[model samples]
Target chain A: MDQRPPDHITAAPSLAAKPPIVTLDGVSKAYANGTVALRDVNLSIGRAQFVSLLGPSGCGKSTLLRLIAGLGDLTGGRIDWPGSAKASDGTPKRDLGFVFQEPTLMPWANVFDNVYLPLKLGRLSRKQARPRIMDALAMVGLEKFERSYPRELSGGMKMRVSIARALITRPSVLLMDEPFAALDEITRFRLNDDLLRLWAGRDWTVIFVTHSVYESVYLSNRIVVMGARPGRITADLAIDAPYPRSEAFRMIPAYNEYCRMVSAELHATMGEASPE
Target chain B: MSTSAEPVAQRADRRLIALRIALPILVGVVFLGTWQILVTWLQVPKFVLPAPSLIATAFVDDFASLMGSLWFTLTVTVEAFILAVVGGVALAVLFSQSEIVATALFPYAVILQVTPVVSIAPLIIIWVGYDNVRVALLILAWIVAFFPVLSNTTLGLRSTDHNLRNLMQLYGASRWRILTEVQFPSALPYLLAGMKISGGLSLIGAVVAEFVAGSGASTGLAWRIIEAGNRLDIPRMFAALALLSVLGIAIFGVLSAFEYLMLRHWHESAVRREN
Candidate 1:
């Protein structure tokens, strides 16, 4: 093997450290109404894996994602990262990107401005961020819609703008909460394919929340099936599907079998009654 | 030709617009003809119910004096409306900054609005000591006319999109930037609607105040009505009343057109064709 470069080349240890993107130790969340949403969820996601929190409604899947996104604090556990200490004592490090179910685009902003919001928030000059914004919009296939307002776009197009906005930050971890549930079946399938394409290309981790068994099976490398009535993780399944998954894959028996299994698990999860 | 189909649709639309205009004029003619016939048959006194022809003749005879007072009333209305927009929008922005201050001063604004300017004009006349009290009376009318706009605009400012509001917060937008960019733009339709209502109200207020505050020179239409009544010039009084009604319709029409143009693309109220 060739020896490494000289001292100058090896100097100032790389600040590009690949720390664990998410570390939740015994994270429990109880709402103000005394309803425990999540109980002692111990999870670790690696740097660039696409993981899905698959569950029915009221399964604390969104709660878990919000915890990871630093949107809300855990009631009885700790979430830690390298820069967690310097974030003003209790303020979590604002690093994760989140996409909500409703596109939630600013109604007054055009597509380009919406995509540039986070970067502008990060104090980058508009000229400095313009190229990156355009590139992100192009990645979402909304390059021509840069001047169009949110109300003028279709539902699917608005969600694409949202995804573009999320990706413009180039964050390490992306959190989504049922982003495609409101979309039609066809648009949902298209977006699922596009998301997988983006996931395959970028060196970024994702934690997607969805109630759709088919969606969970299709986009994720690993699926965490959660049950309600105090919201616990019941099954964790690894999808051994290959990359660059196409619409043609859905017609295959293997894909059908996986969808059937996840659907059955989801049905079972929703059918579970509370324990006395 | 395809152009033939387009001109056919255009002709249909033009006919539709013409019918729209013709129908209203037809309705007005029918109403006046009925009124003239009924009153002539009923033999009503001329002082109580002058015929449309008599009123028209009186209007033509006294056209010069009537036009002068009409101009005076219009000038006061325009001046008062400008003052209200400037003062009201400023006060609204100031109140939006501090809730405690808004809550404290809002009752005073309500009192100022509801209290009749007619009763107050005499006192103002004594204080200002002249017919220049017309300006003060116009100011008083304008205050009432604009506060609803101030309050409505303030509410609209506070009722911004929550997620977008959060986005602004995360972006560290200053209070003024948020006000000008997000809050003000969102509140525009509401403010304009309030302005539409308030524009007519300001004109009414101007005439009403002029009735009480006019001295010798700048007598508005309201004062002319009073002068006609004192002289038993019943048809002339009706003519002044007609001019006032025309003034009101003109003010409201101008405001509605402005509202339509301003919000045509964005707001539902102003959008013409929806798919």
Candidate 2:
């Protein structure tokens, strides 16, 4: 396992003073077959922060996110959701929502039903969740297609339904694993814009995982660069760009500079490898 | 899949549906006409090859007896089919809920499937008692019909999307809720597919079992075929055979329609793409 400490690009003095919403201290995950997916990753995400776990393939970015979501067990160390309230299901994790890389909508379920899943599992009645489900659908611009099944929707629309499903419960922490990676650029950009709009002016923590530097830079305030071959964090840097970050933000030099920095850091992280 | 030319699409869809029904019927009429004309033109013997008209007449003459046999055969077929569905689905669910149970018993299920029911029909008939041939027939038919549903439903249950399972787990859904809401529904198309196969097999099983039991064992269509064959009443035999074919077609049609109804909304097999 790679034991080197993560090199912070800026040391993040701005975030150092604030209390973290989640703290990952030396969180390590090794499979039973002896493959180390992650190792000694320390991360403290502040409340409402948009953090991106960015890396090349096999970097365990996804594994880290899953560990944080309580979807998988860590073989070493621990994760703590500090000050989190116990969800109605009796887990502190219910205050969280997860969006997989795939849209992951139930193929048998229509739009309204797919969005209704999270709440439905919480034992909320369909009648009780109707308005909220509609609200979530409208937020994703799919109010007219409630009866449509996942097979009927375009890839982008399916992802929108997935997003709606994730947001229906209004969880404090939203974990998205490259949610827009499979979409076309036009769709991806539109979804990126939609996601940023939703994240704006709300106290929601979103830990997004992506291999795309531009995506990580555009969507997240802080990007944690990771390395493969016993996946470990290599660098952490803050975007520090102002919000309501518009398309015009993409055209600006500072945005390009941040992207270039992230790209270089990511490329460097990709360089050190014990070949498989 | 809906297009802006809604009326045109609707008309085309209607035409397609009409063609599906009409083409088969038109072919059947032409086939019968040719068969009748050739038989009459060639002076074929009545016993050698009866024309469609002679078969029709024989059908009319034996209507009461044929209907009684059909009803009996259908009862056994339907009863066996229902038992197979219940047994298969129940066994599959039990297997899915416990790995140890599945591991211990799945090989025996495979063994039952591989061993031909025809080979065992007489043995089963003897074992169940010659006096209770109907119970024997039911047992043989259920054995023949239940495996497909069992295997297919098990596969469907196992094939539940990993991501969906994780999503449900993340939501903290009860195991029962996950089984009913996700696994059961996911398994429906597979179960239905298996049932369609089983529907036909159950009929065959009932007939095969009755055939082995021989004359006086039951008043089923298979028995009528056997009885007619013994007397060289070829036309009556033809009539019984025709009825059996019709019954088979009807069973398939009903099961296909039911499958379409259950799956037309979401399953890929049932959904029609305009493109």
Candidate 3:
């Protein structure tokens, strides 16, 4: 009761107030099969903001995330990394992290080796990258399991290793596509908390894709609810929840309110998607 | 109940292990015993159907020459196996790198694999010449052993997890790094499996090639079997055949052990699962 919420913990600041790190202008993606995955997705992500692309399965949230990561080419549009110090060939920023729906750890490699991948690709010697790799693993509390292979770890542990691997590069942007969807409830809740802690302690921009309204409500400062059948942004709601959010936050009325708002928007989108 | 059942489970495990060893030996004994008994009871001629005891005696009697021939066959088999593995894996890596090259070369590999070694042995001997008959045999063995490694490894390399491939791409991994770090490790189990099949095939190829070469060239175990047959030394022929079978088993066992050593840590196929 003595603690106060942070001043910035209000609605997402307007574009004018916050400096944009990346801008997606008229971004449209059409598959070779004539499927319009995303259409004219005009959005600007501010630096270090926790943004969630919340939608149903077919809403192309994952597609949008992939676009940002430069894993696939956009049919028509441009992504600009404004004020980026690094090279811009319209490829994924070299220092960005990506976590797929699966843990995506190499089955052959132990946790340490898996975490070392990005650094290894960066041409850092194993000995040189060892300290940073250890630090990243320690961040995810997987320091002890460094020698354990992916098959030996539990589902949640594998995901943690994945997160650790992503963080190893100290990436400015972390793009995750339904990373916790495969996990059980308890593990998912714990990971959500852990992810928030990591995010709070760092200045990393996160673009998380998920269909879960509750998850979107709990983690994100701004939730961009997307609609299918063309796949365009339907609503952008900001949850003004304070951080250092604990298990107690789930009990608060505001949390439920945010969840309800997201769910309603999602339901409306789904309704519009299907007609009798 | 859990505490009490623990000992029972341990006992059952021990019993299972014992059975695993015992059952195979028991089957072998019964099989040999029936063969010995039937040969004795029917008063069968040794040339037509040698008894187990006669075969054992003949094996010892012809041990020196048989051992030499066995060594010759083994050397050829091992050399051919090594060549197959090297050639197959190299070609597979090349195929994985270029779709056009793979499209051009893959059909010939398939053709080589589908063609029986028996049919090819005579032509190989003629082309390779009697002076280099062993080289002809080696070539034939290599042909038999190469295809599985190529096909399996190609499938495995191509089957690198899409997500992992995307992850590597996200990291801006070089194609070489992607191959060494991701594709190679993924293909290892498949390559090992192919090697296991190739091990047995290599031995068979060596034996078949030697059989076709017949009488004149290097006297391998297959040639010894042919010689024994011509002279009505049926027991010696049986002994040589037994040695060939043992060599095949030994090759398979060695390859399987290699596979286990390589993959036991990570691969689901090699990892121990709890029931």
Higher-DockQ candidate of 2 and 3:
3
Top DockQ hit: 3
Residue B272, model 2: lDDT of 87
Candidate 2 residue lDDT tens string, B30-54:
9999999999999999778889999
User: Where in model 2 is the C-alpha error above 4 Å?
Assistant: A1-9, A86-93, A272-276, B1-4
lDDT digits (tens) for residues A213-272 of candidate 3: 888888988889899989998877777777878889999988876776667778778874
- DockQ winner between 1 and 3, please give it: 3
Off by over 4 Å in 3: A1-16, A88-92, A271-276, B1-15
The TM-score of predicted model 3 comes to 0.92
Candidates 1 and 2 compared: the better one by DockQ is: 2
In the order shown, the candidates' DockQ scores are 0.31, 0.73, 0.82
lDDT tens readout by residue for model 2, A51-158: 999998999999998888888888999888787887688667547889998998888889999999889888899999999999999999999999999999999999
Descending-TM-score candidate ranking: 2, 3, 1
In model 2, residue pairs whose N, Cα or C atoms come closer than 3 Å (at least 3 residues apart or on different chains), thus clashing, are none
**Which tens-of-lDDT digit does each residue in A1-276 have in candidate 1?**
222222222111121134666677888999999999998887666677777899878889988887776566679888777443355576656566778888978666789888987887678898999999999999899999999988789999999998998888887778888999999999999999888888887788888999887888788777778888787777666666778799888888767666766666676677743221
The worst-scoring run of ten residues by lDDT in candidate 1 chain A lies at A7-16
Q: Which is the leading candidate under TM-score?
A: 2
Give the least accurate 10-residue stretch of model 3 chain B, judged by summed lDDT. B210-219
For candidate 3 chain A, the 10 contiguous residues with the lowest summed lDDT are A1-10
